[model samples]
Target: MSVEIRRVQSKKEKKSFIKFAWKVYRKDSELKKYWVPPVVADYMKTLDKEKYPLYDHADIALFTAWKNGRIAGTIAAVENRRHNEIHKDKTGFWGFFECINDQDVANALFDSASQWLKAKGLDAMRGPVSPSMNDQCGMLVKGFDSSPVFLMLYNPPYYNNLVTNAGHKIGQELLAWYIDQDLIDIKRLSRIAQHVMKREQLSIRTINMKDFDNEAAKIRDIYNRSWEKNWGFVPMTDKEFDFMAKSMKQVAKEHFIYFVEDKEGRPIGFSLTLPDMNIPLKHVNGNPFTPWGLLKFWWYGRNISAFRTIVMGVLPEYRNKGIDSILNAQISEYGGKHGLYSSEMSWVLKSNEAMSKLAKVIGGIPYKEYVIYEKEL
Candidate 1:
């Protein structure tokens, strides 16, 4: 069967592009078990060129593949000038990718993305980045037994084969580690944390929600500086940082966020965790506005017992000083008192030995793996 790839133009076409993911996942009951529907309205905003911060420095083209008049796949080809400027590489990105288990359809989608990117003078293409690294940006290659935690992604196992057959290579591997709160030795962790703090002359404090903007500013600074050395790191501008911070604030728990400070009270590192809202989000089925959606959200929201450590960073100078251990101990300590009984420290690059070690130190079991693929355009 021939697959026809067309650039999405009209608002109706864009809606179809977003809704196509439901069709893809729901086609199989087993695949639906682990898939959480992202809020449709949120994606609508992202599709709007004027509303999304990424558009300020990026160009994106959405495309859909049709087979026998039905949508078979969707993809977005992106040229992020900001990423290129920082990384000094002529790389384009493909994201918001979803397709049926058809290599021809997947290949057509990839061809559309590659042609669009190549037309713009980009030399390479890399992603699955539903937009950017700051967001969900990987293809799940392992651990398909359960649902992904909050902000993570789940996909059909055949996605790996589809990408590889499309001529993409594994550019990087991302790992997710599961930590059992019940198994944590709080006393031992606290002892090590205390020693690290005393030896480093550092103090830990919770984010002050009352001073939300100011706190976010401090965190944005630490975030850019701390993660700058990581592979594929793209510095978030103040506008982009503020945009993300606004969304996160709605779901953020003050106590679940922490900052490490020096004796002088200057912040050096931070950790941000949120309740595994995917648990309830799954119940809402992607829309939390409808009457049924609201009821489901409210009921399931109360039972959320897991947390996902979304981002944790320590300044380069302070990394080996054990600030990460202090932050981890605090999470296990406070989370136990509250209702969070388990956590996932995720997307740690396979090459990041320090973080991988920290996850294991906290008794984290490596569970899920995701891959970012690349192709020479």
Candidate 2:
């Protein structure tokens, strides 16, 4: 039967559009063990006209693919003004994509997304990027062994072939590393960090929750400035930064957020790590409101054995100063003392050699990879 492509319209259609992935991966034994069903509420936030401030700066369309009256795939196309404004390019993004290993369905989803973006007057379409790369972007190309970390993506290996066959070429790659306890040499790290800190007047400290607003403002400055030259770079608006801060506060561990300040007390670098909540969320099987599910979530929070480093940045002036190593040492020390057995530093741009080298220096081994694909519209 031919595949049917349709834009999501009604509330009922939206629900099925978001839930299609669960049905596609449900019976796969490999995914069944670790899949934390994607949260419907979270997906809703992306489409909420008022909640997502990004809507003010971008155009988006959500589509689902149907075969034999069943949803076989889904995708979203986004045109981010901030991204285009910063990069000075008319590139649109497509994300939230999924499908069974069916070429016709994949082609239908891609064609719909491409046509949607083309109608928006975009010059090129690149994805699978969320409204922003800061959100979950890229299709999983490697590492199928475990569940994805919180806010990370997971997909079957066949996704790569499906995307490539649909006239998409590799746009970029993101790397995820597994940091096991045995790989880290604490003694060497401490000695190296101590020497580096003493010689360079480097100081690392946890973010001050009491001054969170002020601290976040500083982080925004560094983040926008540090990555200003990156490909597809976009300066997140103040509203967006505040929105992120509010969300992070709910699950953020203070000690896991560290900043490096110079002798003059200017914030030069920062790192933010999040507990691997998926370890516990998986037990809930994607239902958080159920009584037993809530209990399991709380229990898992207390017993989490791993964390994911979500953000790490340094000002342009501080690059190559070994500041990252010092900050990482502090983070590792805190994690070790607090029962964290492993950490994942992830989504590093494949072309970012400096950061990639730093990951290796910290005993991180590349285990998972995600790719962004693009085609001229």
Best by TM-score: 1
Cα RMSD (angstroms) for every candidate in the order listed = 0.9, 1.4
- Where is model 1 more than 4 Å wrong at Cα? none
Task: Show pairs that collide, candidate 2.
Answer: none
Best lDDT among the predictions, by candidate number = 1
Worst 10 residues of 2 by lDDT: 33-42
Q: lDDT by residue for model 1 over 162-248, one digit each (tens)?
A: 999999999999999999998888899999999999999999999999999999999999999999988998989898899889999
**Candidate 1 TM-score, true structure as reference:** 0.98
TM per prediction: 0.98, 0.96
What C-alpha lDDT does candidate 2 achieve relative to the native structure?
0.85
Stretches of model 2 off by over 4 angstroms after superposition = none
Ten-residue segment with the worst summed lDDT in candidate 1? Answer: 334-343
- Per-residue alpha-carbon lDDT of model 2 for 211-291, expressed as tens digits? 989998988998888888877667778988888888788778889899988888888999889888888777776676689
lDDT for model 1, on a 0 to 1 scale? 0.91
